[model samples]
Target: MQKQADRVVQILKSKGLRVTPQRFAVYANLLERLDHPTADQILNDLNQDAPTSSQATVYLSLQTLRDAGLVREVLLEQGVCRYDANVEPHHHFRCRCCGKIEDIEWDAFEGLSFRKLRAGLKVDSYEITVNGVCDRCQH
Candidate 1:
């Protein structure tokens, strides 16, 4: 809707990035989907709405959004990248049976001690991806 587009524009402008129609459309698509989507998937959905974007534009928009810390990358498989709109601290769970990814509450691992690591390896930020059959798949 117009609200989503305006919100995307606000965030992009706050980050001092150029707001192109293609970029806004791509970002709007990302915001609407909870599923971590790849650039190709985003493009396909965008094509359904407006079929004027190239794959490269999607990729560039994703890169820009990630660089601005508005989106996060979910790299579970080699050469297969997914995009997450939830930039807040959290982990991920991947359903092996369905290849679905869901966010895990970051507080669940609150007590994890990074001090247990070997010397000189400073810990910054990390994301844990739990792979297993999800609840729906277990049925």
Candidate 2:
């Protein structure tokens, strides 16, 4: 967590972006939370810690972090958007029952043939989202 806090500043400076409290707080929160959280959810959590941080601040901070390539935005069902701090190449498994998003390893796709993707012109980046009920929800 401490390392991520410092990383937030380093990444911001490397991207030539000014470091602000709200932006730092937002990124720090994202780093701590492994669960992909929506902007509203993030704002709610931040309100508990820093009362001064507003929705706009959180939204703007999210945009800035995304623009700096420090985070990845996950677009889920029903126009729901979740933020992930792990920017590495990976996929997602979403729980249909509880709306939880879990990261799936990139190596998991190694054996599968991406015929459609391979035939495509060029794929810069891609993320596969699988929707199903989680174990906890299955019961």
Model 1, 1-139: lDDT tens digits are: 7886777778888989988988877777888898899999999998986589899999999998888777888898779999988889989989999998888998877677888899999988888888899999988
Cα displacement (Å) at residue 138, model 2: 1.5
Worst lDDT 10-window in candidate 1: 3-12
Clashing pairs for model 1 are none
TM-score of 1: 0.89
Q: All candidates' lDDT scores? A: 0.86, 0.86
Q: How many backbone clashes does candidate 1 have?
A: 0
Q: Which consecutive 10 residues in model 2 have the weakest lDDT in total?
A: 111-120
Error of 1 at 47 (Å): 0.7
